[model samples]
Target: MTRCRLCGSAALVSVVDLGATPPCESFLAADQLDEPEPAYPLHLRVCTDCWLAQIPPLITPEETFTQYAYFSSYSTSWVEHARTFVADAVQRVGLGPDAFVVEVASNDGYLLKHVVDRGIRCLGIEPSVNVGAAARDAGVPTLTAFLDPATGSDVRAEHGPADLVVANNVYAHIPDVVGFTRGLRALVADDGWVSIEVQHLLTLIEENQYDTIYHEHFQYYTVASATRALAAGGLALVDVELLPTHGGSIRLWARPAEAAGEPSRGVADVLAREKAAGLQELSGYTEFSARVAKVRRDLLRFLIEVAERGETVVGYGAPGKGNTLLNHCGIRPDLLPYTVDRNPYKHGRFTPGTRIPILPPEQIAADRPDYVLVLPWNLRAELVEQLSFVHDWGGRLVFPIPELSIVEVAS
Candidate 1:
């Protein structure tokens, strides 16, 4: 971690230290509760040299993604987003029946199913065996492997170069940013497009979205740094699009250097915005730790105040970001009591470090808790709709990121 993972520079500076917490997605089963759980430092640092914000690769992808719990199809909005992206991408690239599409980190075939529906040849390169199986079961051709240079080359050799490679919300997951980019280069045809969606560092900082930091996510990219990372693997960033998903994200349009032309004006505008926000300089990072500390303090104060009033606050989702917030603020089952999720896989499990019990989503309605702390707050609009029934009993929804917001859902 001393040298920058992207540029091999020794000019790393601390952005925020969230202390140590268990890997965010490692939910505990009832039988494994008593056993010792491993934890790793959840600190984020920025490279002055490359401006690549990253954490130490304390936990490897194999430890996290091989048997992953997250399934993309669970989110209604996300699935629609994927569907629309597929439709737009096909039209944007003039993709036809002869074109082949590939999605890296394609979870549960949430996206590729759309391509399949179009009668286009598509494959998913997913690392997790269980999720990959689910993809195959849904009629999507999927390769069960993590994306590295060798794996990318293997997929290219076997299936021929992809006409369109879609990597959404996974650009930050890998430790070797450069190698992953090379893998992306290998999978895509020389003139083919590679679309990557990553949480924008500018948005993460401006919006105070620190809970997204975890071992599974090694790097946070601004368009400036992302451009450099893409170039490291022989891909040139040619365009950029600002997205509303994941709080805020940037969709980078890249291609092999030979075909990559001048970057879009959108890229330049975003770069300017990042610069205006002081992302390139050390000043922007200076107060993030303090802001993060304030968020923790504000949340703990609210949770404690509610506890003292003998009011109950159950959680709405057992998301990884919620675990980070819980562990960082030292919240336990006493404060949260229990959380509920729509995902069946997490039904009987517990949050990693905080050990908050997870129950079926029905439990919230059954218990009629006073306030439901909405984890996965990025889905604020959707969850608010889903939890609108809470209004029947005068229950309010609580969101803990950006700021603590307590909103009443309509009946």
Candidate 2:
């Protein structure tokens, strides 16, 4: 039995079993295709003790991140999201040129570049060599190492405790939630805050966001579980904000527990909301696997129906979430054919387990497939706007998760 990573509770209830899957981010080179790829059980369990939903750590961080294929700058929408956050953070935190900012898992400096542009002292901790080098080239000082107490202390000693430590969307990727929160506590000044954004577990279950679960992501959090994990590291959750990014996420602002301050009403409101949603009970999680199974069946039926009619179907965005969906559903290139992506690094490569060819976006126009399966369904609006040219050939777009449906573009 796998103990809960946060509370060490052996009483774990199964949420959803995605079967065996390779590392979602492991996009393959043509040369490596002939070699056999290994896969591990992509199972999820919720802790009855802390209500933390997590996957077992079957792979190391080095295997997933050291030479990572993902770069944050590739997503324009995400960059703009970062820009907006930095601007808000500067004003809200009363940041000035003298203030120090540190972003953990700061992929490719997409966010930190804006910090530098503002003339504030900034540093980035990114584990991926490829993305870290890109961050440096973009003028953000970066250290390519995993964030832990030792690394955090070294950074604190050199740069002094940060006024604002940004850890957006990276908190879920960590396996040692306690150690990571401790690192956050160590890196921030007494008066400073550590801002963490993670996909809300309520949103994941309610919205059927199973695709977001991959080997790289270790845990999904509710405000309650996050509060417990933070408290263990002497950090206090002072505020919380719900964000639309990643389907639905909560941006938590925390400070050292030794600091004096009352948590904002937002924190209490969210905790109450989670309770109302039945997150505090195991029955709330029992039905999720049924919903996930239905989605898999529905997606397969859609693809098979399209193929039987002798129509073509391709995909857009070769994201890690997309890979999870494809591999879990057993959809291979023969059924969906090739997919397109904006990241040139992924071009000409194949997805990890399914081996779907990742091509340039131009492929969509060339083949003009009857249906384009949008893998990153969260960006459905932006992608629909960008790929509106599909209408020229009467080609339509489809999303598999949350339900299989054709997109209705505004005229």
For model 2, how does the per-residue alpha-carbon lDDT over 88-141 read when each residue is reduced to its tens digit? Answer: 999989999899999999999999999999999999999999999999999999
lDDT of 1: 0.94
Q: On residues 1-411, what C-alpha lDDT tens digit does candidate 1 reach at each position?
A: 689999899999999999999999999998989999999999899999889999999999999999998999999999999999999999899899999999999999999999999999999999999999999999999999999999999999989999999999899999888889999999999899999999999989999999999888999999999999999999999999999998999999999999998888888899999999999999989999999999999999999999999999999888888888999999998898999988999989999988899999999889999999998999999999999999999999999889989998998
Clashing pairs in 1: none
Candidate achieving the largest lDDT: 1
Cα-based lDDT at residue 48, candidate 2: 94
> What would the TM-score be for candidate 1 when compared with the true structure?
0.99
- Residue 160 local lDDT, model 1: 96
Candidate 2 lDDT for residue 291? 94
Query: Candidate 2 at residue 248, lDDT?
Result: 95
The alpha-carbon lDDT assigned to residue 403 of candidate 1 equals 91
